[model samples]
Target: MKQDIPAVKQPVRSKILVVDDEPRIRDACRMVLSEQGFEVALAADGNEGVQMIQQEHFDVILVDLMMPVLSGFEVLSHVREAHPDTVVIVITGYATLEHSINAMKRGAFDFIPKPFTPDQLRAVVAKAIKYNRALQDIADTNSRLRTMVNRLTDGVMATDRDRRIVLANPAFLHLIGYHGESVLGRLIDEIHVSDQVREMIGQTLTMPSDEFTEPTEEIACSDDSGERIVRAKCAPFRGRDGSTIGTITVLNDITALKEFDRIRSDFVSMVCHEVRSPMNSMMMQIKVLLDGLAGELTDKQREILGRVSEKMSGLTTMVSELLDLSRLESGLIANEKSAVKMNEILREQVSFHAENGRRKNITIELRQPESLPPVLANQRNMEEVITNLVTNAIKYSPENTTVTVTATVENEYVRLSVQDQGYGIGADDLKRIFDRFYRVNDQNTRTIVGTGLGLAIVKSIVEAHHGSIKVSSTPGSGSTFTVLLPLVSI
Candidate 1:
């Protein structure tokens, strides 16, 4: 998965200050920005804009070139002095060549004409906001790097190509059981406890390529105390002359992830071993009765056997769902979208579950738009989504409650809804209902045994379709599961 830092507090609302001598233009800009989810602050003219700049930081400032008392240039200059970090955009009623050039030379992030369309203004503001955000991100990265260096607990040591000490932290000396001064000028190979490990490190350093190769896996070293493991990562450092100066290495103790991986592997093996036999026996007996291989029975006896068969069928469904969910969580699901009639596919799956609902005295209704559009999706994948949702509705609903399934075309997309009035999900459990192995705690639900992967599988299927699913419910008022899919032209 692509990892990026999560937005801190809804992206700071992209604060924008619009400065213009005309209140009408300022109000117009404010309304446009506010509609686009930006936090807007208005300032009348350059002087007032400067005052706002001093009072608080604005992410991006909009300055009108022609203003009374103070021109846009003056406001830009004051802001550049007070806060060079804030991006300034020149908004002018009259687009003059000289004014544009002057604004550019004076460090304006971008320029926009006063008679600009809302879309044009939006584009300029987006660019300015992105620039400001990039600047802040760079600053944050540098701060984090400095903090990492300062927080090292071991005696850290870094050397250039000439073997001269370029960086050294106090922890490096203590970690090596040596005086800090003694290790500063010492070659890295001079301090090792194992000749083999030292030779490996030497070979890595002497390699012709400038790229640094960190040991990909953990290695253990037997010191006087006991066995200790260290994880090492290295990256080449470059100088201003574009030459590889040396390598930076960070070492960490990794006894936890290894131990956790071992325990997890063992637990999985144990679970698989424990579950395989009973599930197999249940399935074998079900097949025998399903094939009429067992002794002949009367209608009531066959009905009783059918109930047993249904329970085993549910179990099998759960196990299959669990396996698929494991694959998705492990990132084993591939991207392979195909054109599919979403409503048609959903209708077919709903028929199977509708029969199950009928057996339990529940009514399952399927609603499809008259002219449903095809959606880009995976066929078997979306069937699993619909099945899981409808099954849950059937499972939770009262004996005679109607479970309505609806698919409608809406704004270039299709929404599939499954509503049930069995026992509603609580707000707390509703949040985590899609998480693997999550089950609601209550009397009404504990009777229904499940593998807890049904909703999780449904969530994964919806996401794999590049769509989303949401649930809304009141504790006593029932629940609704809605799946949204983008419509694709055939």
Candidate 2:
């Protein structure tokens, strides 16, 4: 079969304008540029050149310095003011150093002496043509980028090192509730926005150039409609030399997602509450039968009932954890807080888990300075955090291994870390360990009893207290969970 070949498109010819008082010079330049595949136009004087420029766009303009009606300097000024992208070249009979410098200072791309050869004209025009094309390309790219950003729904903004707004799309202005036409060059602090957003941007602006961490936060914004949740992410913007120049922030509306999450958490809470009551009653009745309060039973009957009780207990524990998590998600937990001595909390958790560790033949160690700064935290919530971490450490570690709990002061925060010599998590599993009901599915973990809501609850509590939690692990070595809480201000 004969396939049809696609036609190749020819490159567009560059347009050139020659403006001179001399008729012969105009004709000769036009003929030369036309022969070089440029669309050429002829103008008699500087006034004629300006008229032609107004009529149409030209890639390059060759104007004579000494002309009637208007000087080349005037035409250069017009081109620079009106069509800054158009390349201007000067032609002069008086080709002195001063003339060339003045022409250049007036924005001329290059100048050629009047008594010149065809090759010299071609060389200078060729250079101007190349420069003009590059400028056009850059302008086109910038236009396209602006169009794309303007049409986006997500808000995008950029700031300079001085925290002045350098670029912003219409969406950004709308998101920030700004009614002005432009905010360029205005200080970011002048804009009305949530302090959380401003603080995030400030952090990115002050971050080390070598660090490319992007900080993200979900903040609530109120308007006529209602309260809207916006997720703002900020990162350091670097220059060509890899130095931090400013910051870029992107805002996305996530109000619907947050509402959906609230609905889901409420539903889970209801379900857990209803299930827990009946489960507890059934467990109580089962215990009665197993204790021979109702009647004596055979060995097999007792064994079956025991197994059922065990399964029921597991289910009950899962329900309780789910309810706790739901409450955390609904912002009903951790409401009451005060200055808490973290060292005391650490000591209490270690002592509480010491018996369990000894039953498994594992050692529990506590390491801390005599005195430590207190953290602003809920006493019950902090106790839960320490209990969950220590219990997990002891549960995961093998016999004869040691679990270490440490507390230290880090800047304005208190650092609590629990290290365990256990079957560590894989990289893929580590990312989602804090997600609700997410459990590692390895063989070693299959034997471990967990509702998988412990870490999720820990994370929620930490964040509610304006703190952070981090985990690091190796495959066979162990895992370490670290929490940082702001210290109680004096």
Per-residue error for 186 in candidate 2, Å, reads 3.1
| lDDT (Cα, tens digit) per residue for candidate 1, span 1-490 | 9899886684458889999988889998998999999999999878788889999999999999888899999999998999999999999877889888889999998899868899998899999888999999999997897678758864345666754556655554434444534555667666643343344345445644433233323456654656656554443455665455665555555445556555755675567557766877987886787667886777887788777877777666665666566566543233335457776787788777778988889998888866677777767788878877888888887787899999898898888899988789998898899888898879888778787888888887788667899999988668999988987531
What does candidate 2's lDDT look like per residue over 117-174, in tens digits? 9999999999999999999999999999989998999999989989999889988887
Let me know the TM-score candidate 2 reaches against the reference structure: 0.60
Best model per lDDT: 2
Tell me the spans in candidate 2 whose CA falls farther than 4 Å from its real position: 1-10, 94-97, 272-490
Give the root-mean-square deviation of each candidate in angstroms.
16.8, 10.4
RMSD of 2: 10.4
Structural RMSD, model 1 = 16.8
Best by TM-score: 2
